[model samples]
Target: MTRENRRGALASLVRTLAVALVLLLPAPAVLADRAPIAPAPSAAGVLGATTYPLSLVDDDGRAVTIAKEPRRIVSAAPSTTEIVFAVGLGDRVVGVTDFCDYPEAAQSLPKIGGFKPNLEAIIGAQPDVVLAVRGFPAEIIANLEVMKIPVVILNPVDFTGVLANVERVGDIGNAHDAANTLVTSLRQRWDAVEAKAKGAAGRPRVLFEIDASYPGSIMAAGPGTFIDAMLKAVGADNAVAPVAGGMQYPSVSDEAVLGLAPEMVILGDAPYGQSVEALAARPGWDVVPAVRDGRVVTLSQREVDVTSRPGPRIVDGLEAVAQVVRPELFGPSDTSR
Candidate 1:
């Protein structure tokens, strides 16, 4: 080959190789940006460490740290307040939202506000630490920070997350022993219920009624929801169609419910004394098999909330629901009823 021609060919080869390398190699800067953010170690993460340093990421993604155990704590969400008590931090909680109505002790505690908390009430309590769930408005979070109140947002949208939160609260409240015991007992109860469900003669079709008052106005767990996860764990078939419809809660037509004809109707346990009988009487509900066979089941509001709030109580809630969904599996000795 001529030198000039050979040189041109080699140049072309080099260009092709360079292009391949560019495509194959990842950009270091982008990779660095995409890396996971590691959580700082709480005492629970440390080997044999009893006292743990605590800090929680707020709703705005800001870190709120506590040097030691908080003397006075305020729970911004009703479920979170329940968790505080579940983790043995009830004495520390000075104030709770109006909806926190568990363990009886919580009802007597001063009320700050409801879903949208009042900043003035929260501040007046002078809480050293505040436990909140996700979706706290930016304005409220900003004001809390400006007033120098530390807000620790708990992420408990499922069973595992609930257990993790219990351990976390135990670590934060210096109630590690209680947390460990609670988690262990919770695991035991859950295992028993799960075993029963798996051994069940036949898993019944379940339709969870979020709002039975209006049979047409229905919300059910379809996919990626804690309720759906729990139902599966307890070996029940979810009647709601699982598809990519963002949590899969739709205003299902009466015709559709009638056609689906679930074996059992699972009613949400609401605070205002709601039941499946109410659902049965709703327009176009008399045809449902659950109503016809008297298989309508009522669960407590605490059993199925948006996020299962990572705690021992969630397992308790799961077992309670399982008892109703599959009474045969739970057996005659079942104390859940």
Candidate 2:
């Protein structure tokens, strides 16, 4: 062959050798080196289909929208924290209110302060979403926006709002199915309790006290509050309705409670860790008809405080009342404790 032919032939031989080496490489090695990265799941999948249009009217009246499902969430209220955990998004929650005690798991999560919130602590969590109650101060909400953390404010003060809030949390957490089951079960349980309570021949008169020491300034449930609705649901008459103006910290008089004469008194587990006996022993409480008759019954703080938080807990609350007011209706067992 000529010199030029030899050079061309040499180049062709080199190319063939290179191709042979490539084919002889181990398949596993080739694959391991050239493997493609898997794409992350879309926001919709993370948030759930029901949450696609997730948005809320803030306290300032602006329609705040969360364009995507949040991976790191900060809940500003105890009730909202409970709602988040109930909806099965507890794993995504990175921050919670200091008082969130339900589900037991919440105790381990980072606390972002209470209803007022600690903006710096919230920001430190690097949350993509922040949950707040509608009545939260507008200025705090505005600050959250300034930090670029999306906020969804929920208002679950009444029965209807509580149901709505459950769905809302489910939507936010991409757990609509769980939310539906939760709300439906709650309704059924409450309905069953109501039916049983109503069937009783005698409906007991009840007085619910928030602070027993201050009988003249007692905080009681009246119409429109969850406790008020719960009282009626369990077929009990509220003694404070006439005295309470359907607002928090309703001013009730000693004479009013004495005059209404509640056959049963429902006390919430307040000043946490204090027992029913302690509340009953408080000064001036002995004068209340409920205390005098040994009718005082203590309930979980979760059931009464921050009423109608919108979840299965409300049913638990109503059930508690039924057991207290009409024990025979709920069978002989005490399920309220």
Candidate 3:
């Protein structure tokens, strides 16, 4: 397969496996619906300082020790890249995957390959530490470890976990102050959305379409996916949740979707040429509430990136979803930000 095709396949595989992995593992307290716990005032004196030879554990439960504050960092995933930059470690980033194209400056960085990363390119970056995520090849991680490269895997299952991962990245980079501030702002934004959502009349059933390439069987975010969590957080029920049968990303047929009668539809595949007009043009789709009422929300490529990624910008995704689900409360969708 070509590079693009390979990356696409890898992304699909990752999405399919992510929620399964979460299900097999014991849920962490940090994954609770509440915001990340704030550090006590007494801990403030040392919050900015990270002791050297730091021993830590990643989401994958691998033990890693940082010999010193890493001056050169490499990101293996777009989410990690965004977290590294958000934590004030962008300058230290020497390499990133081909998919890491956000924050503008990241686009100028040396590409370290994508999906299956180039080991040589990673080594060439001379990184003190590499920030990775789940679904990264285990053999590659083993090779990097044998080469004495510290690879920290960050896999957050929910919004709360996302905030915790931000702090974890900050700890790795010795930019705890910046990470804490970013998490605080994210939590505040999340709380505001939650508050607004609570005042809404009722939770509407929303269909979050992931892919419409196979129009006969539209792929959608199911019960355990981040999109489902986002809809829940924004006072909306997932139309697919009731029929997903525990599948994270389920494929639904036109008849099934029609039966569900979703109040709104979020086209995550809008960047791939799926549009409201095209959806409305479909035969027998006129009966769907979203199609009939013009309640379908189409996401731009940038908006899709922000919403799909479980990174620092996820709160931006939450706000966007809130706007779509409860426009009367959160106002119109603003993708420019």
Candidate 4:
């Protein structure tokens, strides 16, 4: 071959050998799909469809808008903490209040104090979202907004509000599917309680002592209080309502309780290891109608407290209250809560 032909032939031979070497080698790796970093639930069909930059009015009536999903969250109230965790955003919670000690895992998170929150600690966490209750000072929320953080206030006045709060948190966190599932189960549980509660015929007069610490006057749950609402749901009348003086949770004198004449008295302090016998032993308490009739009912402190919190577990509180008020309705052998 000529010099030019030889050069072309040599280049072709080099290219052919390079192709052969590549073919002789082992095959390239077939990479597996990478796991999602956020781990959100599959919720496309569960909620029909979701539109972002959604605007919502919070329990505080503040018109808040969320432009995108939040990755790091700070819950300033125990109720909000519970709502966030229920919506499957527990992992995203970077900080919670000192009192947000439910679901076990929440107990270990960094504490930002309770109702009186430490703003610096919350800001240090660099949260994209902050959840507060109704009582949070406007100044704090405004300052957080000044820092460009979204603050969603959640204040559930009653049981329904509690359920709505869960969906609200879910909507903000992008976990609507989990929120729907939670609300469905809660409604079912509520229906079951009502089915039995509706059967309570006596409409027994009930009295609830909020705690043992309050003295001089008997602290009772009145109309508009969660405890009173629960009492009404289970077909009972709150003894404090007629005499509540327009207060949702009122303090009454000895004469007031004696006059109302509750057929059943609920000692909420029982959860603190207070005893029914001790309550009955109070001066002049032996003459109280409920005590005299041996109708003073002691409830599971923890369970009953749940009802008073105005959160998702309030149903559990209502269930305990129903069992206490009307044991017979639950069948003879099914009185355990």
Candidate 5:
């Protein structure tokens, strides 16, 4: 009951209260650790626009119109067939050419034959639109036009053209959402490849044989060709550039090929029994850098057909080439057949 004792007791009580308050309070920056961190959503899907009546120009400089959604589409070329399916119109594809074989589903479609398609079969399919490439005989395109079936020519000369064709296919098929999504994905992949390619070693001179078998016969990819552009994009130079002569595909003799002395050789003859071992054993190819460096490579037949063509699957082809050219930078998607 003394004054000093009472003052001492009050000070002790204040200290105890301060200690309890400190225990109840959170640690510094505790909110930073406890606040629910929202995770990023996966890029799983895309939403399409609600409107329709999209019009565009085809590769042949013709003003094409998509009045209503295309219920049935006939792809007259392999590249054309690929772009059609890539834009999410697989179900709408009623007919395809004998050469159109990638999505496996295309192999099951009704065939219109190769080079010059069976017009009767195409008409029988009764497609709302017919997609063709620039090389599909002018007569075939004209015949389709005469039939009153909308024919859109898709001949992509390069990577950009390939993307444009993909979007155009979607526009014609009325699958804008799917097209946009696909384009975004493709661009992302290509950008990634380009970024990695910038840091790759100096460009290697490459010889791209269009056909694998060569008993004194040769067709190689030249300047302004898709393979040339793709090789350049991935930090490889096309050896055919020296003898290209303004031809996208030029027939070269064995002497011409020997003259180029390409640092690498990519055989487009997957359909044939061509292999690195076989290419290395060719007559007078012993001194070639491709044989010396063991850089002779071949892609699957499907990959060769797709990558060579300017279409949505072209990126996949790029993947295969990049793997062969600079496997250190871009890993192989598949090494075996």
Candidate 6:
């Protein structure tokens, strides 16, 4: 196989693993039924304190009780790590997965494996609580529980779910004040983008490219995914949604993309060396409206991380999409965080 083929195979394997993990999660309807914990403001306008022995139903539909504030945390996913740090609990994070690279501080933390966690390493961390997302093996969770370690699984399906997870983490770490403030700021940013989108001239059809390493098979973000939600929230239509065949992430042929006629193309894989120039050079791709019109937008590494990761910065992802889809309405996005 050629180098491109190897990359394609690797990408396919990664996607397969991601889908398999997501399948382990409870249905979206089930998670939606569980109401998010609302933080109450104190007389001084700060969020009220969290009560000890806090009990709540996590996204995985499991009853988890945190006896007291967690002093040491183990994050099993990048999103979970971001949530822990965002809620002002970074100092308490003892271990993070190999994939967790944001916030600079997490980079120096001990690694607890990725995709498949290192059970021994996790145990060595001696964490007060283990924070994880969907896709972690059920057996691992059971093993941790048997060892008297609390595992909180957080799997948010949409924007609202992300905010709720942040609050939930705060509650576990007794950082309700920081979580409330962060959620409020995120909501304000979301509303601001939505207001701008409402004033746009018209909604444009956009294609979010997940991987373009293999020209024979192009991966795209489809319905029921964070990318799709961000596009819709910013008042743009997903060009691949109609032909996705119920898959959250689908591989499409060049013909299919041509038929979709996307007005704008967002390169979610730009960090991996994909570029507007490279895309334009592809055979027959130049005729595509987005390419011919030079409407291909390449996202930076930080942009890709914020857009793809379901964490506190997802609102930043919404704004990034808005800037690309409706540049006249929204200005350049801030990806500094």
Q: What digit string (tens of lDDT, one per residue) describes model 1 on residues 119-170? A: 8888889888788776666787788878777777775556666677777777
Best model per TM-score: 3
lDDT of 4 by residue, 1-337 (tens): 7634543332222111111101111111111122211323543345533477768888878888767677789988766776777667888889988767665788899988764788899899889889887667688888888988888888776778878987887788878888888888778877887787876667889997754434445556678877787788888999989888897656677766777878888765443334567667666677877788777755442444365565566676677777667677642222232
- Compute the lDDT for candidate 6: 0.75
Per-residue lDDT for 24 in model 4?
17
Give each model's clash number: 5, 1, 0, 1, 1, 0
Ranking the candidates on lDDT from highest down gives 3, 6, 4, 5, 2, 1
RMSD of 5: 26.6
Model 4 lowest lDDT segment of ten: 15-24
Runs off by more than 4 Å, candidate 2:
1-48, 51-53, 58-61, 215-217, 246-248, 269-289, 300-310, 331-337
Model 6 regions more than 4 Å off: 1-47, 271-273, 332-337
Over 1-337, each residue of candidate 2 has an lDDT whose tens digit, in order, gives 8634543332222111111111221111111011211211222333336545467764345787776767788887666776777767778889987766665777899988754578788889998888876556677778888876778877655666777788777777677777776678767776788777767787678876644333244545566666678788877788777766645345566666667777777654244333456645655667767667666665433434323344446566566566667777653433333
Lowest-lDDT window of 10 residues in candidate 6? 25-34
User: Order of all candidates by TM-score, from best down to worst?
Assistant: 3, 6, 4, 5, 2, 1
Local error of candidate 6 at 40, Å? 18
Quote the lDDT for 67 in model 2: 69
Give each model's whole-structure lDDT.
0.60, 0.61, 0.76, 0.67, 0.67, 0.75
Report the lDDT of model 5 for residue 212. 36
Better of 5 and 6 by TM-score: 6
**How far off is residue 85 in model 2, in Å?**
1.3
Residue 214 shift from truth in candidate 1, angstroms: 4.7
- Whole-model alpha-carbon lDDT for candidate 4: 0.67
lDDT of 6 by residue, 243-265 (tens): 98997777788888888999988
**In terms of lDDT, which candidate is stronger, 1 or 4?**
4
